[model samples]
Target: MSKLKFFVFVLFMIISVSEIRSQIVINEIMYAPLDANNEWFEIYNNGITPVNLQNWKWKDATSTIRTITTQSIILSANSYLIICQDSNKLKIQFPGINGIISTNFMECPE
Candidate 1:
């Protein structure tokens, strides 16, 4: 209500927001069905902030795993992040029961 109180409140909000940390959460995981040339994994950032995926990775039932340190990616505030076997050729499959969820925009080759 008072000037001092408002300033304190604003400062607290800024600090609290900035202090928050983002966790790399795997919201969904699936294998591409189109020809199965490569597998893909989807990650979601369910935090109130953003995160850099420079040194990220993923694993499955097998011993073979994946690391995304070379990939330059940053998940938005509230969006799904895609990781494909072939970043240049393969398409990012959305979290779907099958292959009926992705927009197929990047699926088609130019």
Candidate 2:
């Protein structure tokens, strides 16, 4: 009986962890821009706890997987993170926008 209880607990934990990981989702994407370099996407953390995004990756339908960041990035709970092709250009295009900005994002698919 104890072993069965332990197995159930482990399954619950695994499901919880998967749910938490799924909370970080792609919220928005700017595929086409007046300046191609201004392309970007928004990722939102809807979970209650912050998520560590170190060594995360992304890719479009036509491209291979690309690394998003190698450095540690803690996305706060209920907040957004912006990944951009060119941080400087995106800033100039949308002045005073909020959220954490990360560079080196590749072009998004249409």
The candidate scoring highest on TM-score is 2
Indicate the TM-score of model 2.
Answer: 0.79
Model 1: per-residue lDDT, tens digit, 60-80? 445445465444556667667
Taking all chains together, each candidate's TM-score versus the true structure is 0.50, 0.79
In model 1, state the lDDT of residue 90.
43
Q: Candidate 2 lDDT, tens digit per residue, 1-110? A: 99999999999999998998898999999887787777788999999899988867787546767677777889999999998867777777788887746566644333
Off by over 4 Å in 1: 1-22, 32-34, 87-110
Identify the runs in model 2 with alpha carbons over 4 angstroms from their true place.
1-10, 106-110
